[model samples]
Target: MASFQKDFKIWVMDHLPGSALLSEPLSLEPIAGDAGFRSYFRLNTQIPLLAVYSPPQEENNLAFVRVSHHFSSGKIKVPKIFAVNFEKGFMLLQDFGTELLQPLLNLDTLPQYYDLAEELLLDLQLLHPGDSIFPNYGKPQLIAELQLFQKWFVDKLLMLDLSQRDLSILDDLFELLIGNAMEQPIVIVHRDYHSRNLIVHNNQIGVIDYQDAVVGPITYDLVSLLKDCYLSWPEEIVRQRALSYKSRAVSKGLMREIKDQKFMKWFDWMGLQRHIKVMGIFARLSIRDNKESYLSELPRVVNYVLSTTFNYSELKPFNQWFSERICVCLPRYPWYSGD
Candidate 1:
């Protein structure tokens, strides 16, 4: 504890001159984060502070810093960066207390929160196609992420030992899915925009864990919020809300050319792709990283993939395969039972 205090105190002092004096640095606690990264805490401050210590060697520290700055400038509510040391891979950020959208989202507050999310989506789509600041989420990357599902979840995690023929079929299905996603209107995508990544502070939603922001389909983040893996809503209700959001976006001239049906297809296809990627990520976190908490969310992720794939005639083959093979082999988790 003392050693961690010394290192954290020194780190804060070096980056933020007066931060150490805020309070005596306390022991580090592990904070729950997405599958891609790990984070630790440094509390014991009068301001009830926490510092995210993501190692530079393990993750893209520079991208996090840059994206945070870009989004902050764009009026997105991300935690303000107080200080940063790129070479050392450390940053001091304003602590947005633990008021996550997941725990705070109830029936009464759902509509209001969804409205705020819609506004954010409008702002996100305002980003142009050729934005140099964000990474591209084209066909190749989408296919690659889907393949991770095939490799990790189906093959390694489930120990399915799929034959070459089965593997080839899955690969072809993934290619089709990626092609569908690439055909949609592209925008800046907050790759993991969901209830868990949203912090509700002072009656406002602040986004976090957006270091992996990319230039992707406009519907990507929308579906991530509506078909959230951690929480489930009725399909009809989600669709109605999605259409409402689309109407607002069109009125705001963010998506001027696309019709309602075309936009719906974009939402469904992007969701299918994201759910596939998330399943693989969750499986990897459990089997490889020894994190079991995400395992409970697996069934919901699978449901999103199954539901979206069943929407189109072209995806019938993929849909049938999931029902016969995947769904039968893996029963739904308890959390997915109620809704």
Candidate 2:
């Protein structure tokens, strides 16, 4: 055995069961392009294929285990946990191969993929606000997420040391956004339900990166999937599909009192908030963490925010602010072409 592998085996043996022998273990090859605290590796073994998750911290380990069990029991296609050593921050999981939804999305397959995603979203809505399996999406959490856009993307990424007046405008806009969110009916929200986090395995769509899931607006995950940063769909098609989702949600009694038009507004505004959050996250990943690959996707995220804001008269201030200040510094995303 190699030196690092030997050391890892010794550590695991001390902390985890059945680590006495690795059973034809292979070198730990790092999974590329993870955007979060957890690091993954493929542990090729003779007994069975396993993936390892080494979280940088242990704060969310309990939640991860609990929610994974909950979703798995609910028949959602998440990876089954084989072994977990929370103190060591290592988890051995069933290997779900990495043919993610992004490459699978073309004109012919887009509808089918989206339908599968919508089904998952419907399944998620079955989880209610007070479910013990997940965390609540309370006021403080909403405010903190909104502040990411203000702090990272608005100030840091844009390099805009805003004047007091500009700061006030930003604060007011954030309050309005959060206020709108808090007014919506809550459901289980898969906080990062985007293409890259979904795996196409054994002819089924399996969800990953769900440890951060919370109770939030019903439309939040829908918007995250359809208005994804890594992929772009046509506005007309997106609108049609979003409405289709709304109809399904209504049928499921997920939105008992909300009208279709009002639900559509909720969807749009939630998307705007999510996209703004993503822009900040992507920017922070690049600037602070020295992961510059996500910088390429910034334009698409910014465009989603811009297009959504432009659709509403009430968002005119946000629209003008972006046009006057942000647009000049960072031109329209190349994919948009002013269309």
- The window of 10 residues in a row where model 1 has the poorest summed lDDT is 330-339
Query: lDDT (0-100) at residue 101 of candidate 1?
Result: 87
lDDT of 1 by residue, 207-314 (tens): 988888898777889999999989988888889988988888777776666677877888888788888888888888888888877888887788788888788887
TM-score per model over all chains: 0.90, 0.89
User: Candidate 2 on 97-199: residue-level lDDT in tens?
Assistant: 7689999998799999889988987987885534577678877887777788768877887777778877776777777778788888788888999999898
On TM-score, the candidate that comes out on top is 1
Report the lDDT of model 1 for residue 187.
76
Among residues 3 or more apart in sequence or in different chains, the pairs in candidate 2 whose N, CA or C atoms overlap within 3 Å are none
Q: After superposition, how far is residue 41 of candidate 2 from its true place, in Å?
A: 1.2
TM-score, structure 2 vs. true: 0.89
